[model samples]
Each structure stands twice: as C-alpha cells, then as structure tokens.
Target: MTTTVRQILQKKNIQKIITVSPEQSILEALGLMAEKDISAVLVTEGERLVGIFTERDYARKVVLKGRTSKDTKVGELMTQNLLTVSPSHTVDDVMQIMTDNRFRHLPVVEKGVLMGIVTIGDAVKTVIDQQAETIKALSGYISGEMSI
Candidate 1:
C-alpha cells in the first residue's frame, strides 16, 4: 500500500503546526521554533501561507549577512517560493522532491489549504519501516518453504 501524507500524520498522531506571521521578527519566529522544537515555521497572514522561516534561512540571510535577527522581519528572509506537496502524494513522491531540492521540510496542502508538514526524518523512518516489514514477510515465506 502506498503511504500518503494523511496516513503518516495519522500514524504519527501529529496535528499541530507552528506558524508565524510574515510581519513578525525573525527572532520571534526562532523563538516559536525553539519552543515547539521545530526547524521551520509557516509564515502566514490571516490564514494565508506567505512563506516559511527556517534555520537555514536564518543562517544564510541573517547571521551570514550580519543582520540582527531581532530587527529583521521574517518576510525579508523567509522562503517565499515554497515547493509544497499535496496530502494525496505518496511517500516516494515527497522523498524525490526533497532529495532533488536538498531540503528537509515539506508542507502538506490540499486545495490550497495547509494541512501538515513532513520532514526528511519522517520520510526516512517510513521507508525504513516499510523495508523492515517487507524483509520480515519474505523471511517468513522462506522459512515456511524450508519447513514444508
């Protein structure tokens, strides 16, 4: 069975997503991320996703540029051109997208509505679990044949 983002979310029981406004300072977003123990925050404006603020963005746009996080707005540094995936997208699809883009986070959306986000860690875990299950089944089949 192909695993979808919805299945992943259900399996993980993850429902909440940390979000911040574009007008908010980078420091504020960082604080939220730290509080939530997340790497990224969806930059929203009245339910509209405008961008995504992440540690990578901070390192590249603020710290490396000598810009103070407290004074810099998230909109200035957040990634606006987001590559999102739909909830119906299979795990393999997302993995490929993330691999090609060299990023960790992917926003799960449906009908332009943000649902959840998945990380590289999540995808890797799913793939590993699937492989382990397959191996177990194959081993069971081989053992049954040997015993017969």
Candidate 2:
C-alpha cells in the first residue's frame, strides 16, 4: 500500500490553513509567513485559491526587480500557474511533481476546495519513514519474527 496525501496530512496534523488575499501587500503576506515560520502562503480571494506566494518569489521578483514588498500586491508577484495535488495522490507522485517543477510547496485541493498544504520536507520525510518501515519489516522476516 502506498502512502496517500490524506495520510500525510493526517500525520502532519495541520491545524490551520494560512492564506492571504490577492490584494494584500506582499509585506503583509511575508509577515504572516514569518510569523508562522513557513516558506509559502496561499493566495485566495473569498475562499477561492488564486495563486501562491513564496520566499523565492520575493527574492527573484521583488528584490531582484527593485520592487518594494510594501508597495507591491501579492497578486502581482504570486505564481498564478499552480500545480496542485489531491488527497489521493501518493507521496511519490507528489515528489515527482515537485522535483520536475522545482517546487518547494504544493497546495492540496479536493473538489475545488483547498484542503491543506504539503511541503517538500513533508514528502521527503514520508519517503524516509516508508523506507524505514520496509527495512524493519525485512529485518523481522529475516529473523523469522514475522511471516513474509
């Protein structure tokens, strides 16, 4: 059996979905991210996901372009072409998507509703945990402690 996004989310025990309005100042969004110790913030408009803002966006789009965060709207810099994943997606599936796209964060959506967010760290942790479990099972079988 493969680990699913739902399982990952449950394990993560996400308590809140941190979001910001598209019209909000980039500085405000960055402040929220800093307060939450997160690298990304979901951009929404009345419960509708519009885009996503990340630290990379600020570094490349704002600082490099000489645009002030306080003077710019998140919508102006947020990545509009989002690649989302569903709860049924496997950890490997998401990892592949992230790897191919160079994404550090991915939003979880179910039936057009934003469910949660998954970070690259989450996927890597899941993979590592799964590998450990496999190793443990193999050891148990080799020791004749469990049936194959």
For this target, which candidate reaches the highest TM-score against the unseen true structure?
Answer: 2
In the range 55-85, model 2's lDDT, one tens digit per residue, is: 9999999999999999999999999979999
Can you tell me which runs of candidate 2 are displaced by over 4 Å? none
Stretch of 10 with least lDDT, candidate 1: 139-148
| Strongest candidate by lDDT | 2
Question: Model 2: how far is 71 from its true place, Å?
Answer: 0.8
Q: Any idea what lDDT model 2 has?
A: 0.94
Q: Candidate 2, 111: how far from true, in Å?
A: 0.6
